[model samples]
Target: MPVPVGVIEQRDDGPLRRGPRAPAWRRGAAALCAGALPALAFPAPSWWWCAYVALVPWLLLAGSAPTRGRAALDGWLGGAGYMVAVHHWLFGSVHVFIVVLGGLLGLLWAPWGVLVRSLLGGADGPPGAGRSAAALAVVPSAWLLVEIVRSWQGLGGPWGVLGASQWQVVPALRLASVGGVWLVSLAVVAVNVAVALVIVSAASRLTATVALVLGAVATGSVWAWAPLPAESGAAPRIAVVQPGIVSRAPGSPQLRFARSEELTRQVADGRADLVVWGESSVTHSLATHPSLGRRLTALSRTLGADVLVNIDAPDTDARGRHGIFKRSTLVGPGGPTGVTYDKMRLVPLGEYVPARRLLGWVTSVGRAAGQDRVAGRRQVVMTVPRRDGGSLRVGPLICFESAFPDMSRNLANDGAQVLVVQSSTATFQDTWAPAQHASLGALRAAETGRPVVHATLTGVSAVFGPHGERVGRELPTARSASAVYEVPLAQGATLYDRFGDWAVYVAVAVVAAFCAWRGLRRTPGARGGLLRRPLSAPPVPPAHTVHGSPARPGR
Candidate 1:
């Protein structure tokens, strides 16, 4: 029954066989779970270290895919999972619609998945150093493009940027100052790529190791040698008033206004330089409701400091159209300072339904804005007098605008001394939304080298110093109180403020250069006439007859 030592065996049923593949549903679930892993690295958990390796599982799953199509599917499902996980708190407001948005946005990752398969998922074996090197540069660049596209205001401004997870890390903050969040994001993705390569193939370990070392060296060099924000020796005491969630009845805005007034009165006279109230702290416009103006003037005189408050009320624009506008108005002792900044970037569904004619029915499903809020024309930096006879330049952002780095950077460049963000997450106060919203202030502060006051109505109000460090104790959702921060002013412009998103430009160049290189590699040689074969060339043989006698001229 034994076969000869040198004999070969063949089967009619099949040529070769490998292990059975995982089912589609199982693969999708794995990708989803892998994608969600990065959310834990953000606030509430604040496991900042987890972010460094959070994308590993997703990368592994995509790299080992049996086909390029399967890898693309994994990428899309994983992206959807990431979006849902990071913005899970929106479920209380948008319900199932958030998943729909997530799926639509997840499409951006399909090409990235295919790119991963092409570069790393070789059937022969683990990729060589050449492919791994290309993966290192190209993969992260592709990821950055995805982030940039999704950051549009319609899609959801930059709410949960991966670099933002490093808001609390000092070295990462330094990198942010140099290149804004884009650089930090680039570094983070590159590290993930290097780690994935090291884990998948022994041949790539050397390249991955080199990348890791170079990354560490670059980070260290920037931290040690980068220009830091110089201390201006002026510490302004900024007080933030947060009145925890009030009633939601018909007269709730009036009740919330009264609560905020009560908290403002609790602060001792002359102890604060500036008092800030949360967004929508005043329900009506001061021009129409002069009584509200008088109340704010009384508080300003009592505290011997100007009061900054947000107004959400109906107003007739120059075009005679009536709409609600969220405005940040500054109140001094004389009454209204006549200085205000209307919120330019309105929250997508929360403020207005995009393409209202088609999607207006969403209002029936949840608490989406019945009417779209009007957007402002430009940004404003108001001048306020300090207690020491000096003046302060204050830049104001209403709620969602704080998530945008360019707004704050532009304000700082335009000579704003301190950036104030008035926010209210009353709808999802009990969830992680409040904390996640608060964390953005730190990133903005680090990027602009200006202290950020993230004063909120419901809870989790916080302040970050110029270096992205917490300035004072945070006022949590359960507390209805006023806290003052002795925020230090920093001088000199950050590299990010001067250069403005240079990291993004560099990334674009890298991607473009890589594309050009690939195209050049595939082009026909200059000496060759054309890429196609000529009819004069010998005809190709069939796979079954490769080893048979060679064909003669006409055989």
Candidate 2:
């Protein structure tokens, strides 16, 4: 009896004895660091490579324990690290209050770890093909779900979605045409899953390697064979100005007027057919202030080109209700026709704090404090004269509005030949915000199958062609400068622009079906039997054990 009981006990603890249990805090710390690795890789541009391996340690640790609570904790740790690191630039604008914001934002990761652990199972057992398949499909879906949720009105808009990390990767960017940014994100998650499988299971090593190789091959093949929009003609010459004005400065309005004058002078003597200024170039109302309109009209005529100027000012509607219109006004060789495209998507806090009555105190400090800019309700496309005597329609996105895929797609659907983003990044100076903001234009360009010009205060101003390739010149964040480039105006629609994010909705449905199936199959007395018992369950002894002698332990 003693021998039998001892053998059972030994068998129960055998797998546990193979390795020391990692401390909760250590595992949490490792997860945090792992999540942050990819973000630190920013600025260098090569840092995106870290994304492939960054989540491995966190995944491994989550697999080690395999409990729902543990997984949530691990995910929270990792998410906190990733969000804090990537958005550290927020601190530059928000100051020490960022500590609270970072911690609050870290909450986004909790479910990620839980999902990963559930998909992988505990470290002692192998995740079978069923689990592997679910992981391959569900992980990326979960990420997209989270991104969509976080892109709400009050939460931060889509700033650093994983798909944006591959901004410079041409092949991955092509995936945007098929499924918006979700496809690229899925591909990345799939790669990470393959890598995790290879690391964990020796028998599945060859299988994992094949999966990884095939995924790469698939991505590469699509990139090489993807049908791109045909080049219509030589790109129209355009110039963008970065005046680098601080919004709160007493002389900011005057300074912007002077900079606009100078940029117009430069374009007038140059070969530019169109010139663009950053958002709020005229920080006064053009309709109410005739002098401002006169200056823009003179500039457009002097430059002999259509000049797109962003105006941030208050205007009264037909009902005489006073409201602000952050608009893009096109001044051509003719004059200002009062034709304008007001910004649709407004940045929370930065534009107008949600629940302003309750959180009004939040606006008393930091970069966006005391600002009460109103949002526009329409998605209007502004038409300007092309240098070739043809009219070029532009979809104008003000600042944070450019980050939304649907917004840009709608603009293209509205017959916009070019996507123009007028932005102000001076508040986030020298941070990844500008680069991240600039990167989205590439994705938008791909999604819409149209060239996009991002003109910003501070820098990272650039032009992306219909193929999502950077054309013309790009200015770094360190300088107050200008760039002129020819951007081809392509007419047509991309599959994504036409169809929208139907793939994402399909994926969501699939994930829902999977979760429901798993839940039903795991129900008591189901045909497939229950999932493996909890880790704390006692182990059973081998049957062919000798009496009176110590029996061998079960694996």
Candidate 3:
């Protein structure tokens, strides 16, 4: 029936507002698939190109969500998939609790999903180039924020960031220098958004395509044109000792030390300026094992080089408290310089349980310690007096710390010409963990413009230049005891080391603009996109009818 003249009619568009919402099961399935996509971009699988489109599945789901609440759920589910897939090996360490951990950390991306859908208009907002551009900028910034938050050691530390997915991509590593991994992360997310728009934005495909092209060109130009730092004065011949082993279960520090010392003997001729051992190379404490300490001293004197060994042992304070510490100590021909760098950022289940009383019940594949490895106060660079001449500074990052970009950057900024990662990936050798662990050194080298000596126990020992270029062939997961490589120093600093994460500034600006735009468009009972609540929130009742009369309650 037709409405009478002067009477108004409401237009109902489609089932989206109230139709049987996408089934809970389908939504969940999509989320899991989308979330796990990024994992293929990481190690073991090592499909680096996959990262370019990994988030597309999740982004598409979120951009079309019926309500802000549903979008958040989708995002959360996807985030959960991502967490579980990337850190699935944690099951070996934390056992069944990995599920709970993924769920908890997945909360980090719930708000992000909602934001993406809101910018895509979710079920109600109009789609246009303006909105698309805004989404592209804000979504990536939001991702960075999420990464930064979840990166806290309490959560899991910053293990598998989206940018680190590009650890082997030279250009991406170049991007790391200026913005750190966060910057590369930002770029990756932005590219994903642009790619999404090509399929979704019908009216503005040309604009989306142009934006995509420009983004690609700009990233390429920055990488291709960037200048490589000059080679500095000295090229030191350094020997890295990796006492390869199959398992560390029955492995005592003494046994590991003996194996390392033997390997050092093979490589540490007068030709070597320094001999560096992998983490826990010296299982005994110098204070407790004076004999072993004397042996190291004698070895250094005989080789005419400085010895840097990692001591994983107990240090009892005057308070009579016992604590285990993993430290990198420098001992010379004369004696110990007393300069040591302790492992600051430790692995959650591997090194220490976060909450021992509550969660300690969940044990790792490796035995959980009664006490965690104590954290170091700060970053230290050990200066070794070159046997031939002037002194060369070496910065230390313990096993897990190499996975964090900021730690390496800190050491480089502090005048470390050579960055050494003393690591033990024996736990996950059969898995892709060893290769993935070894690859992280490339980004560190590129970001800091310093040579990285990635010495390890078990396998995958490698070296890289200031630009992340390989200095020599890497030893894979095997029993290769030692390798010697001459690393040339790169002079000066990359814009990244000098400037810090400039990408964060871009993220901050985008976020601020998004917030401001949301605030200005506020309507009665209608909050802007950023603050939109889920379908669970009570819908606002109409204040007045089109006829200008107050509408009835519950109408």
Q: What lDDT does each candidate get?
A: 0.86, 0.74, 0.81
Q: Report residue 440 deviation for candidate 2 (angstroms).
A: 1.6
Model 1 accuracy (lDDT, Cα): 0.86
Using TM-score, rank the candidates from best to worst: 1, 3, 2
Q: Write the per-residue lDDT of candidate 2 for residues 440-462, one digit (tens) a residue.
A: 89899897899999998778898
Best by lDDT: 1
Q: Is candidate 1 or 3 superior in TM-score?
A: 1
Order the candidates by lDDT, highest first — what do you get?
1, 3, 2
User: Over the stretch 1-555, how does candidate 1's per-residue lDDT look in tens digits?
Assistant: 333455332222111124456688999999989988889988888888888899988988888776667788999999999999999998878889999988998888887887777677734347899989998999888888888999999998887788888888999999999999989998898899899999988999999999999999999999888887887977999899998877878998889899998889887553888999999898888889999999999989989999999999997644565779898999999999888888999999999999999999888888899989999889999999998999899999999999889999999999998999999998897888888889999999999999999999988899999889998799998988998889899999899999999888888888888878766654366235222222233445543435675555654
**How does model 1 score by TM-score?**
0.91
Give every collision pair in model 3. 69-534, 93-364, 177-496
RMSD of 3: 6.0
TM-score of 3: 0.89
Tens-digit lDDT track for model 3 on 160-238? Answer: 8899889888789888877788989998998888778777868546667888889879878887766667887869988
Looking at model 2, residue 233 earns an lDDT score of 66
